[model samples]
Every structure is written in C-alpha cells, then in structure tokens.
Target: MEGAPPAKKMKTERQFDFSKCARRKVALMFAYLGWDYDGLVVQADSDNTIEEYIFHALEKTKLIESREACGWTRCGRTDKGVSAFRQVASLIVRSNLKEGPGVFWPEGTNAANWKETTQEIDFCQALNGVLPKEVRVLAWSVVPEDFSARFNCTQRVYKYFFARGQLNVDAMIAGSRLLIGEHDFRNFCRIDKNKARLETSYVRTIVNVTLEPSKWSCDTASGSSAYDMLELTVVGSSFLWHQIRCIVAVLLAIGSGRESPEVISQLLDINTHPRRPQYGMASETPLCLFDCSYDGVNLEWTWQPRALNATIVHLQKIWVDLQTKANMVRRMLGDLEELPGASGDSNGMTDYLYCGPPAKNYIPLLQRPTCDGLEDKREKRNAKQNGAPQTLLTESL
Candidate 1:
C-alpha cells in the first residue's frame, strides 16, 4: 500500500462558478446616523463602522458574497461619529434585470416579470428591510460599467455645526470668506507625517464655504421651554482631516477676543511662521455630510424622498423628544431645595446659581464672547506699537 502511488487528493474547496453570470454595475445611496458607529470606512476585525453594517446588509440580501468580489468603492471616508444624509458607494454584482443576459434570481418560484421590477422603488424598501434601524438605503441605480464613486466625484459637501452662545457671528463669517479658494491647508489638517503616505493629494480645493446662523426650539409641553439654541452652518466642497474643526477652533477663539481677527490673515500667510497654534478640534457628533455631487456621466441616480425624508424626520423627532426629557430632568434638579448642611454637595445649588433651567452639559455652548472695548484698544495698541519683525524663516540667523 505504501509503495502504490497515493491517489490524487480530492479537492475540498468549493469553486464558485461565476463565469456564467453577466455582471452589472450598480450605485447605491447610503444614509446612516453615525453617533453610535466609529465612521464610514471599514477596517479589519472591526464592527463599529457604517460600512460594516452596509456590507452585512448586502450579504444578508445576497447582493454580494464579499466586498472584494463586488469591487466596491466609496466616495468619501467620513470621520468618526459623523452622520451622512447622503453618501455613495458603487459595486458590481450579478444582475437579474431583463436588460442583461444570464439573469437569475435566488432559487424559488420562477417569475418571468421579476427582472422588469428589480429596478423600481420597491428595491430600496426591500434592501432597507434588511438594514439596521440606524442605516438605510435610499436608492439604487444602474450605471455604466466603468462608473466609479471616488474618481468620478466632482465635489463632496461637508457641513459642520457650531452651537452659538455669545459667539461673534460677524467675525466667524468674515473669517470664512478667507478660506474660499485653493491653499495649502497642511496646518489645518492632521496628516500622518510619515513616508508611507503616497498618491493621496492633501491639497483639496474649497469651492465655497458659508457660515449661516440657524435656530432650534424645544417643545414646552415635552417639559422644555428653552427656544434659544443657535448654530452655524459651514459648507465646503472638500476638507482635510480635522481641517474644518481646526479652522472653527481658531475662529471661536477670535470671536471671543481670545485671539485677534488679524490672526486669520497671519495664518493665511505662509511666508510667516508657516504653522498655527494648537487647538482642539470640533466635536464629531456635530458634523454631517449634507450631500455629495458628481458628474451625470458617473451616475444617474434620483433622490428618493419618500423613504429617506420620512426616516430623517422620524429620527429628528425622537432626538428632540429625548432632549426635552433631559431638559425636564435638568429643570427638576435645578428646583430641588438642598438639605441643610449637605456636606460639600453643591449638586442642585450650582444649577440654580446659573439661573433659568439647568444643563447636563458642562460645555453645551462653546462660543466665546465678543470683546469690543478690549479689542478696540488692542487694535489701536498694535497699530501704534511697532516692534522688530517676527519671522520664523529668519529666526535661525
């Protein structure tokens, strides 16, 4: 038996026969509230990303066996805890549409008209059913075989939120105007200072940036009477990592008179220090992707409002209701009479000292107050006081 040549081992791996399938490219609109997730980009051995849930749904619905097999590509890599109203991804998959050959549906009852109905709105609903409550598919569209979400994108719009509290709205708006063109934003971004970073361009163009004030009101019957929530909306086509947050940090400093308005001009001038002051970035929870745009040739997708809009409204209502309850708890805590000699427990006392309603947030409002008198004097002093030139370029000498 040993001398006899061993029979060839039978192959155990299952070979998936995709050769008979006619592949078609499709683009899908993905929307998710990112507060509970890590971000949009997927990582190995990680389940806390919007992309992971998406691929899970895709596999659950038999869209693809794996992301790699589908040749999946995403338009943007949003940061941690950031939500998107509309983001895009493209992938290739076998098609059952009547327009393509080798059409096949999952094994079941055979319906000749199935291919015709695959491209309808019902497809969105069908996919959404498999997706989690936080993630939803807005629509799917058939695209040209060569279409790509990343390369074909003309612009990506990101919206950052800045809650208002004594914020110098005028100065922030003025500073935003200076950012409306192409410039090396290395100082504003958190780029990896390593040699391995290649091919990816960090110098993105800012087609436009707008800082507009927005208002929010909480329902009184829901145990809230505070109607004084103000915010700033900043829209930009493309942004570097933490770029928007860095800019907002400096502007908030300027608005509150912690820094001078002229600092903006100085930051813009690369001939000077060529670096910027270190400041904390804005909260990721407040950032949202409003929309993403691309050339018509790249895709032919229509916005399906019935489902997405309804979901958005429903979620917003839930959020508002929660906030109202929080406000109510805060008010009750504020009204509580402290027990005499409550041993260093200022607890409810601090809330009452702040007046009106109590707040659960230590820094709910981050904006700085405008200082007109001190700012005017500082401006005059700076103009009148002439000092030696300050330039890091010549500092070595």
Candidate 2:
C-alpha cells in the first residue's frame, strides 16, 4: 500500500464545472498598487500584469469559461507603475441570484422575499484570497446586460504627485487652466500606433484641472516647500497615451520659470507647434488613476465579514511596513546628526535645487536643448519605407 503512489489527490482548484454555473453581467471596482505590474492590460510579452491575476482568480473560482466570454471592458488602461483607487471593469460572471416574475426581473423590480431567496456571489472574497497582496478586488455590482464599463464611464480622474522644487505653484495652476477645453493635443501625448491606424483624432476635452498641496505637506509656514508634495488633479472624458505625464512635464517646466504659461497656448496651436517638444515626462511612480464615474448606475457594494477583516489586516501590514522603514531612516538621520559637524546646514553656495538643479556645470532648460518631435519619427519611417535597411525599434524607460 505504501508503494501505490499514495492514491493521487483530485485537483479541485483547476478542474471545475463551469457549464452548470449561472451567468450575469457584473462590474468590479478594484484598487491596486501597480508598481509590481506591467500595467493593467494583459500583453503578449508579459503575463505578470494585474489583468492576468484577475483572470486567474476568475478561472479558479469557476466564474467563467474564458476571458473573452465575459465581454470584459476596462474603464481605463492605466500605464505601467501607475496605481489606481477606483478602477472599474464590466464582464459577464457566474452568479447564484434567483430570477422570477418580480424578483430579479429585467425591470429591476424585486419581490418582497427576493432578498431571502437570492444570494450575491462572494467575488471580492474569492479573488482577494487568490490575488497577490499588491492587488485587491474592492467590490462588485450587478449591472445591466447592456452595460459597458468603457463607454458608460462618464469621466476619469487622474492624480500625479511630486515635490514642488523651485517651481512656481501659482504659475502651474495658471497653465493648468489653459487645458480646460477641447483641443488637438498631439503635442501632449505619444501616438498610439494601433489607434492611429484607424485615423483616430487626438482631440480630447478637459473638464477640470487643478493643482493643490497634498496631505504630506506640513501646515507650518516654516515647512520646506521643496519637500512638500503637490497633487495635480485632472478630470476628463478620456486621455491619450502619456498625456497626463506630458502635461505634468510641461507644468514642471513652467513652474521652474524655464517656459512661460503662454507656452501652453503656443504648443496647443496647431499652426505654431504641430509636433511635441522633446522633454522627459514626470516619473510614473507617483501617478494614479484616482476614480471613474458612471451616470445613473447605483452600484451597491456589499462586503462580507471575513473579507473585510482580511482587508483590514492586509492594509495594516502595508502601513506597518512603511512605518518601520520610515522610522529606521529617521533614527539613522538623527544618529548621523549627532556626529561631528554633521548637523550643520549647507552653505549658501551649495544650494539644492531638489530635482531640477544640479552641480555648477548643469545646463538649464532655457538653453537651446534638443528635443524629439514628430519630424524625427517621420524621417525614420520614411527612410525605412524608401528601402533603407532599418533595425527593429527599441527605446529606454
């Protein structure tokens, strides 16, 4: 009996009867730390994305047969390393709710005893259990059969946070207002080759734009503005590839007095600047998809007791982890200050520009600095099209 290979255990996780499950249209609200992912969408080159984990959980839970069958549509395809607080996705999923004359009717009129018979699927509990700690399924809602997360979304909110170096906060605010209406933003975003193939327009409308101090800043007047975190909030119908980051880059330049606020106007004018200026975008580490809005959809989010407890524990652990590192750094700096001549301030000549400033020989942006634009891309493409041998295109991060 000992040599009989121990009577193999049945694999319950992978093998499931999906055909017997009832399907319903649902939308899931998610929050995730995207630093560990290759962005939200599943790509051919990588399987480590947030979407991959969601689908894996769905499969494991026997929620659906395949990703395609779910008719899944995401509200926004956030960039890599960009976090999200209110990401939403619509899909067809397996449900255990009962339908009848009045209860769970197409018209949404529920019977008195409908609540007693119908039961909601524990989507968050199931997915959170299987998903990595960086990602979490916040809640799920029963949506209409015709609901679409992408098209039905009324607006999207994006927030980018950064330290306000020597930049002008008021000037950045003034420049942000110039983006409030519809405009051809070719200069504010990189072209998406796939979308461009269909002759898509670069025109998009900005509903609102504002820059304010984040909670990280101390209220005291003596607090260092260079270390104070500022938040750029943008609300729009839709956005282009790297649009938010490009805009942030421009604002940073404006704040630094390198460019006037009118530069935004000049760049937006098609006749003035058809091609985008060459400039590095803001870092992706502090960018986030803050929220997505839907009109007329009353999403009732239900949290199970066990799942709620698990979420509390998970979040507390993250806080503690950060707190420990912060405390260690604080203590280390205090100890260093106690050393000889270590507590003294820097000399007036050794001023720190935070991010923009550098050592004595550092070139400023006001100087004639080179930047890549559409013309550069056009020339390369033309050369290749004209029978000139070209290597595969590669780019740095």
Best by TM-score: 2
Runs of candidate 2 exceeding 4 Å displacement? 1-14, 100-117, 195-198, 216-222, 303-306, 330-397
Tens-place lDDT per residue, model 2, 142-233, is 78877889999989999987766566889989999999999988778876434242256778999999999996543243343444567899
Tell me the alpha-carbon RMSD of every candidate.
Answer: 11.9, 5.7
The candidate scoring highest on lDDT is 2
> What is the C-alpha lDDT profile of model 1 across 298-331, one tens digit per residue?
4556556677675676578868887889778756
The true-versus-predicted C-alpha distance at residue 79 of model 2, in Å, is 1.7
lDDT to native, each model = 0.61, 0.74
Error of 2 at 359 (Å): 11
What TM-scores do the predictions have?
Answer: 0.68, 0.79
Error of 1 at 214 (Å): 2.3
